[model samples]
Target chain A: MSPLSLTHRDTVAGPVLLVAGELDFVHAAELRRQVEGLVLHAGQCLVLDLSGVEFCDSTGITALLAARQHALAAEAEIVLAAVPAHLERILTIVGLVQVFTLRATAEDT
Target chain B: MGCARRVPADLNASPGPTTGPGLRSAPGAGDAGAPVGETWRHAPYPVLVADRRGVLTGLNEAARQYLPRAARGDRLRDLAPSWLAEAHHRLAEARSPGGGDVPAGHLGDRFFEAHPTPAGDGRVVWWLIDRTDALQAETALHSARTRSEMLSGIASTLLSTLNVPRCMEVTASLAAQHLAEGAVLIAPPQGRRHQLTYAARGTGAVQVTQQVDTRSVPGLAEALQGFPPVPARWLNPDDIPDWLIPEGFTGPVGSVIVTPLPGHGVPAGALVLLRSGTEKAFTEGEEAFARLFAARAGAALSAARLYAEQSAITATLMRELLPPKLGSVHGVEYAGNYRAATDQERIGGDFYDVHPGSDPSRETLVVLGDVAGKGLDAAVLTGKIRNTLQALLPLADDHQRVLSLLNGALLSSHQTRFATLVLASVRRGDEGVHLRLTSGGHLPPLIIRADGTVEEAPTHGTLVGALPQVRARTIETVLAPGEICLLYTDGITEARGGPLGEELFGEERLRRALAGCAGMPAEAVVEHVQMLAFQWLRSGGHDDMAVVAIGAARSGGPPTVAGAKDGMNL
Candidate 1:
């Protein structure tokens, strides 16, 4: 798996986490740690841009869920942006599609 | 060898035959008043000649620069340094025999060798050769050689063993003997207390565990942490507390050198050298040498610690992660095997167990699962799930209800990880082996019929833990005599290896492989699948693979599906 890289860029709405590379077991925890450090407001929505993700495993999905948990704990909303087809299939299969707010692209919402 | 042969010759040549050992021979009228040659007058060293009355006769340019106050015909006692003057007086008074030893003395921070030659008529000429720089160099060279030897000794001794306590003992004793009169080695704090090893010069090391206050000593806590791990400090002797001083160590403290024993990753420990009041103070060079010793000790100690930790992990995983041995239960043949992604890894996310029922009529519950993630974290979760599932054995009759309870248990836990598992209730019937299989987001079992046809058990469900509930639909199937049904993890189908080592051993390949082993025994079938998967993996990157098989015995049984019971003709 390719090593994961993360970039946090703040937009007018909120911080958009630009996650890249393979989000497998090796790097899933890193994403959670990065999300935990974010400063989110009550009304602002946090976007996880997964456009550059080469792969995602079950642990990667858990990390995404943990990111959601972190955002909700801060009274903020989290959205998965530009979700890949494979990741989209897993999110639906695990019933996370109902739990998370999903968008076609980062600029959609 | 050459020096040994030449020493005696040199000694014989030193004593003059005409001049006795006396300070001067009786005055000879035939000898010149001052018969010294021109070479002696312009010598690089200081030289002087005097009569028995102790008057100067001749001196060289360097001697003129060295003894500016002494003029021609001056008495040697008043001008020359006292050590030289005293030697001259002793030689005169003792008379008649000499040629014993050259007198060495200091001259204004410089050392000199005074060689006295007897001249005619009770006169003596003395030569002074400045040997200050040569002596200093010899001393420095000796110490440097000694320190290097000690460093190599420390390396060989400390690195030979992997035992932590033994390494500490050796380090303490070596420092005490070489660096100072006593030494104390303090290992990094474990929990709260630290393990201390103390040794005094000429004594064996002693080990003691004490709750040491690290902040009491300056630079000690930092050294233990290896923040800037290489500095060696010679702290104030008074600053060394009673706790730091070893038991039975007497005399007032004079010098203390503290050095950090840096390790591969973490700091191994710290070394403290103590010298008594009478002992010489530690030089700057000695302090640096102590740091080098500390490095060797640290590397050995840290290697031992890493080995210990690795073995502990290996043992723990071997016991916790290995699947239970499967065999015939209630006349149904059962077998299961597991392989981790890599040989070095003894444990992973895959886990399975076979629990026998109270009676043959009661189906034995079998479990196989793949926990989310990998490595220690996932294995830990797998263990918790297994324990929880064991606690819910009474509810094994209903797979859907068991899945719901497990999902609830996992959801309440702190970890965000999840798992997918397959549960099969196995029972032997008059017709064949009956199985009620349920899949909770795991792949369903593929049944190998008597006709060598592979069929998937009609079971589908969502993964456990992520959702609030598990909505698995349990499906019933009967394995005819000599028929086998297999439950496996995705690790097999997802493994990538081929001629190019980039192909997946997918579901279709798995079905074809199982179809070939349609009538084989449970053990053979599991091994066959494992063999094919390994061949596909072929040193390629893979995940944890596991397979469990349940087969109906063909002995005295009828073939109920697709035939004439000729499936096992081979």
Candidate 2:
């Protein structure tokens, strides 16, 4: 299954990619490709809704890093929504959590 | 003659005749010469002369009268029966200065006693007396001795055995010995029928044993079917149907006595004795003994059954209440350990649940909690709380709302019980990840980053079921890639670390550990944090713990906050 699932909802958060499966070695490239396909632009914020992901291995982690780099290159920002407790711990320990802007829900965006 | 007088001179020399020679009548000198007619009439201590060879040489008038012989000499040995002659010879040999009574001969209804006196001639004076009364007394004395000995032998045989069948066998043998011609049969009750348990005979006959139902042995049934059952006896031959009587049972079976074994419950069987026509029926005392035996047997059987049943129940209950292994969740391996208290009847109070997240897209939802007490009651409450959470998870919007709903669901019953719970939902995003944490008076979640660093996630709510007015704690954190999170029960933190209960690897210690583990993946992060928890406690944690970890990729840039510049990230 594709790690990156694109879903659009007419909510205040705008177009969202609800990543519903694990972004691991099995599907990280697919996730990276989906992020690269997004129409990035300056001033626009890409919302990555992660409520569906059950796991995020190192490979998935790298794909996520690539998504951020892509968005940065386009001068556009990225928002990580519905971050799970396990992933938050990894970020905090690595001091990378301070770099991510996380919210409880996409609506919070 | 005087009672103690010495008789004539000749009499002392020759006492009794060898063949009763002296027992002859006196012969008066017949007139002058013509052959005197032998006067053989009176024999009073008859005087006759016999030689040592038992030849009679002469006879006086009394001798002639006692023997009626005209000849002057006769051989006495040929004149009497051998037994009589032998008696006389024995008397002669026994003779001494003081004479002893001698057996002369046996007569109808009489025994003779003879005394002898020697005379000048080769003769002896023999006096005989009858001893009928003494003999009769002796016979009677011998009969009584035999009966006493038989009774003692019977008693010993009865007491020597412990086996029921052996005892029964001995009983039958004793009966045959004393009663003479009858066989002994013991029919024990077998369900609705009476089965012949034992039968024996000294006659070397194979005893026929027939099975008799209660219907066939009605008289026996009636007597035994009573409280403190008694052995019943049937004496009428007609009472037993001919077909039911064991084969080879012949003669007038004058009577059959069926004695029920006396016992607490129905007798195992009755002891039925078949008396032959030639033998007398069983007396009342024998029936009483059979009943006593049955009573003792019944007690043994009941005791054995009771012991078996009690132990079986105890073992069954233990197996049912204790679990062998914990449930495993995919992507979230779970380990549960439980120990029962020393209290025999108490059940465990720890519980846990792993369910699919309410949002199909979210990470696994895991909850582990414990009731406040230890017992069946606590266990029941634990089950209730676990079941309620499982039921609500699929529909509940967030981890916090699930706890609130559970608290509400238990408000009434919670009047007496309290529980600690931790609920966690894991999700991954492109930049990092998402987690919604809630605590219900439970231990905070342990978050382990890929760098081997650890932190206890803060819970912002009160213990579930603690109060009617309580809100759940909700915290949101986005995990950068390569970090892990753990949610556990207080069994890990409050675990005593030192003698004074002073050493505790509290939240800070756990945070440091998780920080060290931040370099590993989610699975390894969980394992390392648990290892530290165990090491801090110096053993397995003291109570139940549930750990849930979520990790994400690394990004040098800050995780994008949704509408970061627009809305406050509540």
Measured over the true interface residues after superposition, the C-alpha RMSD of each candidate is: 2.8, 18.4
Q: On residues B427-517, what C-alpha lDDT tens digit does candidate 2 reach at each position?
A: 5455556667776656566666555655566665555664555555577776666666666544444444544444655556666666776
> On residues B57-112, what C-alpha lDDT tens digit does candidate 1 reach at each position?
77777787778777888887778777787777766666432444556677666777
Candidate 2 has what TM-score?
0.37
Q: Where does candidate 1 chain B have its weakest 10-residue lDDT segment?
A: B1-10
- In CAPRI terms, model 2 is classed as incorrect
Candidate 1 residue A68 C-alpha distance from true site, Å: 9.8
TM-scores across all candidates? 0.56, 0.37
Clashes of 1: 2
Q: lDDT of model 2 at residue B473? A: 58
Q: Which one wins on TM-score?
A: 1
Model number with the top DockQ: 1
User: In candidate 2, what are the lDDT values of residues A1-109, reduced to their tens digit?
Assistant: 3345556453343346788766654577888787888876687777788778765543455566667777778887777888887666534432334455787887652
TM-score of chain A of 2: 0.83
Q: DockQ (C-alpha) of model 2?
A: 0.01
